[model samples]
Target chain A: MNVFVVGVGLIGGSFAIDIKAAFNEAKIYGVDRSEDNLEEALSLGLIDYISNLDELDKADVVIIAIPVDATVEILPTILDKIDDNCLVFDAGSTKKKLCSTVEHHDKRRNYLAVHPIAGTEFSGPQAAIANLYRGKTNIICEVEKTAFKLQEKGMEIFSRLGMRIRYMDPSSHDKHIAYVSHLSHISSFMLGKTVIEKEKNERDIFDMAGSGFASTVRLAKSSPAMWAPIFKHNKENIIETLEEYIANLAQFKELIENDDFLAVYREMEDTNHIKTILKGIA
Target chain B: MNVFVVGVGLIGGSFAIDIKAAFNEAKIYGVDRSEDNLEEALSLGLIDYISNLDELDKADVVIIAIPVDATVEILPTILDKIDDNCLVFDAGSTKKKLCSTVEHHDKRRNYLAVHPIAGTEFSGPQAAIANLYRGKTNIICEVEKTAFKLQEKGMEIFSRLGMRIRYMDPSSHDKHIAYVSHLSHISSFMLGKTVIEKEKNERDIFDMAGSGFASTVRLAKSSPAMWAPIFKHNKENIIETLEEYIANLAQFKELIENDDFLAVYREMEDTNHIKTILKGIA
Candidate 1:
């Protein structure tokens, strides 16, 4: 099998490594605008060769793993260039825009819209790790729109990567992701911003931050190039979540300010159900 | 030496384990208001035996690892009952009020105002681990108020647990911690609450949450019994930090709402410096 991965950064680079491990005979090609990322991906052994869109004719599989805006802009073009037998898919965080772009294309069955639901705060080819998708969820949207053989092949790849698959519509995927993934990034980024602005002494922050603070703020380090587009693409759902989150913070703040310890205690105890909820995540 | 841990939960139970490991000959006693916790600590081998406030006369070292409000209420009484040569210390999160309560005590020299900056969301004797404090920070407030020999013994205990010590005044400690520690907890709890309220399907939350969401909401699972008191005692500083955080979130929301992707991108880019700040924490 011949595979081409677009935007050879964290997601694409990791996919290249894992897919090669799963299918040793498969030849992998890297495509990215950044020469540095291409070089890094090559040195890291994440790809078999560096290739371009002109070579799409030879690819049996083409995975789009770029920032969502870039995916929105270039997905239709990639679909137009790929061979009919090629099974093209995306690992973008948001799915609605990409699904809509290729909805009416002649080779629509060749394209599958997937949100692999995995990543780290770090980016770039250097951050790529093998088995990044292992034991993670892969949400496949509009699965019925794809051809049966291609869907079967995609499922085989997901299983080879050790992922559990779930199916949803593109609209539902966007809504749930806003609450579960995108809102988390915004909360963490704002948290880091608030602390850095208030606590000017970085030394104090370093000395006082326990593993709790580190875990809560870890997503603040995620790439803005990636997340800004996700937030923008899913703006309506994200805005609703952000407003609810802000309101919750305000209520908690009011309780604390009024010295209503009982109310504060009850609120936290109510939220403690998250313990049971998160146990399933791991 | 004889050591008594006043509250044998996460902090106290873990301390009992480490202190016993370091001082093999030391006799460790467990004291808590809950009989269930006492029994669990005994079964876990976290303490030599169950002891009470009356046993204070025999303890050469007394460690108060309770909620800050409980620490404030019970500290002076524990100080009044302990032997003159006993070295008493606390591992509470807040320091300002605890420092003020014992400011004029005749046995003030016997007390060490210490906050070993370590913990997880889980609590109770079952959560206790052998080296929870290893390679973590210990913030000692008003170290000058402690007598010389007792301070030496306290430092020795901290060293055995593999901690790096930093000294600060009690007021400064509470102020800085409000931003770094307390505020993180609030953000996490509220994030969890908002998601649970919005996402009615537990299965969807389980399926959709990536590691980032898990990390950001981890502290929502913390013991409300332990945290409520900390928030109540440090209400002033926490309220200030919460307001600032809310304002920051509102501004970010406005930027997103206005479709100003550039401003949203810039804000997250600025906060990305936290990646460097967190490197020094570990």
Candidate 2:
């Protein structure tokens, strides 16, 4: 089997490593606009060789794992080039734009929109690791739009990578991810900015930060190049979620300012249900 | 040496376990208003036995690990009951109030104000673990106010627990901690609250949440009983930091709303410095 993975960064690079392990006989090809990433992925043994878009007809499977904006621009073109028997899928954070771009394409049945719910704060090919998809959730949007044979092949691949699959419409996937994923990155980035702006002494941050602070601020270290497009593609949903988050912060501040310790305590107690919710993810 | 640890929750219970390992010959006594916690601590072998306030005089070392409000109410009394040779210290998140409360006490020389910067989202005696303090920071405020002999002994204990000691004035400690620690907790709790309020489907949250959301919201699960007092005691600094955080978030929202993706990208790029800052913490 020939598998071509485009945009060899964290998501694509990790997929290449894990998929190769799952199917040792599969030949994995790497494609990236960045020469440095292609070099890193190749040196890391994440791909057998560097390939190009011209080779699309030779691939049995094509995985698009780039920024959402880039994925939107290139996904239809990739579909235009792939052979009829090839299965194509994208692993972008926001799915509505890409799914809609290919909604009426001649090869629409060959393409699937997927968001594998996994990642670390780090990025680049160097950040890829084996088993990243193990026990993680993979959301497939508009799966019914894909050909049945390609869907079966996609399910087999996800099962081999140890990922559990869930299906949703593209619009619902965008809304929910705006709350659970995109908003978190923005909150953490803003938190890091606030702390850096207020705290003059970096040494104090280093010495005083406990595990809680570290965990909360960890996402602030994510790649801006990768995330800006996601926030752009899902602007409306992200904006709505951001407004709600700011209002929540404002309400919490008012409670604290009013010396309403009971209200503050109750607010946190109510949010503690996230613990039970997170256990499901774990 | 005989040691007495009051309020055997996460911090106190972990301290009991480590202190016992460090000084095997020391008789560790547990004291708490909560009988269930006391029983749990004893069963976990976190303490040699359960003791009472009347037994304070029998202790050569007294460690008060409780809520900041309770620490303010009880620290002076613990100092008053301890013998002149006994070393008394309190591990509370907020230090300014506690330090000022005992600033002029006659036995102030025998007490040390310490905040060991280590913890998990969970609490109680069952949450205690060995080496919780290993390689973590221990902030000792007003170290000069402690007796010379007791200071040496305190250093010995911190060293044995594998903690690096950083000394600062109580006011400075409270301010820095508000920015780095307390503010992170509030942001996380509020983020969790915002998401919970908006995302009604718990299953969607479970399936959609990536590791970034989990880490960013992890502290929402922390004990409300423990954090409310910390926020109450550090209200001024916390309010100041919280306001700055809200302003930063508002600014980011404005950038996103105006479609200035470059500014959003640059903001996150700047905060990427947190990666270097966190490496110092590790």
Candidate 3:
């Protein structure tokens, strides 16, 4: 089995690692614009050979795991090069744009839109680790558009990788992800910016930050190259969520200023329902 | 040694556990307005006996670990009842108000203003766990104001718990804590509120929410009875932090709306400096 992994970085490299481990016959091929990443992935044993789009016809499976913007730009070329029997899937954050980009392609039935909801704050081939998708949800947008045989092939791999599947339309996937995933990165980045700007003494922030602050601001360290594009491709949905978030923060600030602490307490008590929601997450 | 733990919840109950383990001769007495909490503490073995302020004369040390508003109300009364040699400290989030409330008390020298920068999202006696303070920062405000003998006694216990001490003025502690701790809680709570209000389908939030959302929103699960008082006591500092955070969010949204993703990328890249600062935190 020939598996070609484009954009040999965290998500792609992690998938390469798990696929190789699960299937003894799998020969993982790396396709990345960065020579450094390809070399690093090779040395890290995340991939067996350096390959490119021209050789994709021989590929039995291809995983496109790049920035969402790049996925929108290059997904059609990938579909053009793959054989009719080949199963091609993308692990992009925003699915609506990518699905729309390749909607009219002749090989649309060979393509599956996948988003395995897993990542760390770190990125790049060096950040890749085994079993990243274990116990993690894999959101498949427009799964019904893909050929049944390819869907079965993808499901077998997802099952072996220890991931659960959730199906939704491309539009719903983009809208919901803006709230759960994209909005979180924006919130974390802004929290980090606010603290960095206000707390002049770097030493004090370091000395005083508790686990709560650390966990809340953890996503501020995510790769800007990856997230900036996600924010762009899902701009409308993201802007809507940000407006709601800003309004919430403004209202909370007013309650504090007015000494209306009873309202403040009630607000927090209502939001504590997140505890039960979070329990169902992983 | 008789140790009195007021408001036997996460912070106070945790201290009770550590104090009992560290001091072989120590007898921990629970003091709370809630009879149910006292009963739970007794069953959990977090306290040796249910005691009250009237019995303060027997206390070798008193840890007031209730809400900050309540701490301000009762700290002076606690100081008045303790013996001259009894070391009294309060583990509240804000320090300036508590220090000022008992600033000129006759037994002021017996009181030590402490903000041990440690806790979990859970509260109450059932949430108590041993070694909660290990390797965490303990911010001691106005340490010189406490009697030298009592200071030594408090320092001895802090050392036994493996806590590192950082001396900060009460005003400075509250100001910096607003950025690091208090601001994070507000941000998390508001984030949770925004998601819950916008995502009408709770099932989508549950199935699609990733680990990033869970981590960023974890503080939303915090005890409102505890945090509402902290927000009230540290109003000025918290409001300032909230304003700055909201402004940053608005600016980022405008940049996204205008398609200035370069600026968005730069903002996140700059905030990535938090990675280095967080390395210093335990």
Candidate 4:
């Protein structure tokens, strides 16, 4: 099988690496708007060779792994042109609009809407690794819209990559993901901005940041081009998530102002439930 | 030299295990409010035996690695009871109050006010491991107030544990730490609460908490018993830092509401400087 992956950055590059390792006979073609990224992807041996996305004609499978806004514009066009037997899928975060845009296309059955819940703060083909998707969950929304055979093929690829599969409605995916994923990005970016603004003091950030600050604000370094569209497309859910995030901060603030030590302690202790949840204990 | 660590949790137990590994002749005495922790520390070979506060007379060094509120109350008492030759230090977040409360004590010269900037989200004696302190900074405050010989001993221990030491005034340490470390704890806890509160869908958290949310909210699992007092004692600085953090979030929110895509993108990209500052980027 030949796979053509556009937007050959972290996610796409990692997928390419994993696919080749899992299915040794598979050939991978890389695509990107940036020549530098394509060159890096080649040097990393992430793809068999560079191919324009126009070559989707020869692809048994074509994956769109770009930013959300770009995916909306490019996916329908790509879906329109692919061969009838070709399987198309998107690895974008906001899936509702993308699913809706392609829903009526004659070959919409050829496309699968998936979001593999995996990524690093790092980006580009340089950050790609062979097993980035291992043990992680991959959410497939509106699977019923896809041809059964295509869905089966996609599942085979995901399983080969060592991922667990989850099913959801696209709109519901956007709402839930806004709370879990988009909300995290906003919190981290704001945290970075807050510290950078605070760097007006004598100590620069390098001098002040330890592991704690580094971990909490790690996502602040994500691609603005990538995240801006997520926030834009998932605007309502993002807005709702942000309101809750800001409110929680405000409530904690009021507790601090009141010098309510017991309350502050209890609040933090209660939230320590996060440890259980993250570790899968909860 | 022999060393004693009270409250052998993540911080204390790590110090005990690492310091002994570096100095093979080191004898360690474990003391904790919990007998279970003492037993675990001994079983982990973190200490020679579980000892009492009175054991300080026999040891050359004593470390108070408990919560801030406990440290403020118990540390001075331990200092007063220890032999004049014993070197004492603390590994708590807030130092101004800890330093001030013991400023006039006769044995204050033996105590070194320290805040080692290293820890994982895990806690308890079970979390103790040697080498946790390696490659991390150990900040010592109000060193001039400490007796010269004991300060040298403390520095020797920190250096042998593979730690770099930086000195600052207690007041400055509290202010700067509030921005870097304390602020991160607040941000993470609030984020965890916000998502849990807003998203009635728990599976959303399970399915959508990619590495982004996991990293940003990592510190939310920190011990509330340990952190509550740090926030309470450093109440003023924490509140100030939080206000700054919330204000940054609000500003970003406004930029989003106004459809100022350029501003939103620019801010996120600028904050991306944290990558360079954290030594995270190549």
In candidate 2, what are the lDDT values of residues A80-197, reduced to their tens digit? 9999989999889998988888888999999989999998888889988999999999999998899999999999999999998999999988998988888889889988888888
Residue A235 lDDT, candidate 1, scale 0-100: 94
Write model 1 residue lDDT over A1-282, tens digit each, in one string: 999999888899899999999997889999999988898899889988998999999999999999999998988899899888889999999999889988898889999999998999999999889989999999999999999999998998999999999999999999889999998999999999999987765566568888888999999999999999999999999999999999999999999888899999999999999887888675
Off by over 4 Å in 2: none
- Candidate 2 has which clashing residue pairs, if any? none
| Candidate 3 lDDT, A111-155, residue by residue in tens | 999999998999999999999999999999888899999999999
TM-score of chain B of each: 0.98, 0.98, 0.98, 0.97
The all-Cα superposition gives candidate 2 an RMSD in Å to the true structure of 1.1
Interface RMSD of 3: 0.8
Model 3, B129-245: lDDT tens digits are 999999999999999999999999999999999999999999999999999999999999999999998875656556888899999999999999999999999999999999999
Per-prediction tally of clashes:
0, 0, 0, 0
* Candidate 3 lDDT for residue A92: 88
Candidate 2 docking band? high
CAPRI grade of model 1: high
Native contacts retained, all candidates in order: 0.84, 0.78, 0.89, 0.73
* Per-model i-RMS: 0.9, 0.9, 0.8, 2.3
lDDT of 2 by residue, B1-282 (tens): 999999898999899989989997888899999998999899999988999999999999999988889989998899989999999988889899999999899999999999999989999999988999999999999999999999998899999999999999999899989989999999999888888888765555557887889999999999999999999999999999889999999888888899999998999999999898888565
Per-residue CA lDDT of candidate 4, range A1-26, in tens?
99998989989999999999988788
| Distance from true location, Cα of A154 in model 3, Å | 0.9
Which pairs of residues collide in candidate 4? none
